[model samples]
Target: MREVPIRENSIRLGQLLKLADVVQNGSDVKELLASGEVLVNSEVELRRGRQLVRGDRVRVGVEELLVS
Candidate 1:
């Protein structure tokens, strides 16, 4: 697990994916989400616009990213 710092109260799922380097670009985010490979707080999440706040957990593949 790793901490991903955020400057705002919340961030969009797609943006967070890119910000955390989970994906290379917006297109990658779309594809990854469509494949149901993204998880939020241990549940599958497919919405690119889902709002994420501090302490939220995002898992992609073997990596776990915690918002902070």
Candidate 2:
């Protein structure tokens, strides 16, 4: 797992994906989410607008990211 720092109290899942370099752009988020390849805290998450805070774990494929 790798730590991904955010400048705010919360960040949307879509933005986090891009910030973490999981997706190339915002448009790709929808397709990725629909494919059921994204997970939040080990549960499948399909909402691109889902809010995430510090310590939240997001997994995309084999990459796991920890929000900080």
Candidate 3:
């Protein structure tokens, strides 16, 4: 598990993916997200625009990232 700091109130899921270095770009995120490989707080999340705030947990493959 790793902590990814957010400097604002919240960030969109796709943006977070990029910020966290989970994906290379928006297109990568879209394809990855569409493949149902992303999880938010342990649940599958398919929306790129999903709002994520501090304390939220995101999992991509074996990587677990916590919003801080």
lDDT (10s digit) by residue, model 3, range 1-68: 99999999999999999998988899999899999889999999999999999999999999999999
User: Least lDDT summed over 10 consecutive residues: which range in candidate 2?
Assistant: 18-27
Looking at model 1, the pairs that clash are: none
| Superposition TM-score, candidate 2 onto the true structure | 0.97
lDDT of 2 at 38: 95
Better of 2 and 3 by lDDT: 2
lDDT of 1 at 31: 95
> What's each prediction's TM-score?
0.96, 0.97, 0.96
Instruction: Score each candidate by Cα lDDT.
Output: 0.94, 0.97, 0.94
Tens digits of lDDT, candidate 2, 2-67: 999999999999999999888899899999999999999999999999999999999999999999
Clashes of each: 0, 0, 0
Error of 2 at 6 (Å): 0.3
Best candidate, lDDT: 2
Residue 18 C-alpha lDDT in model 3:
97
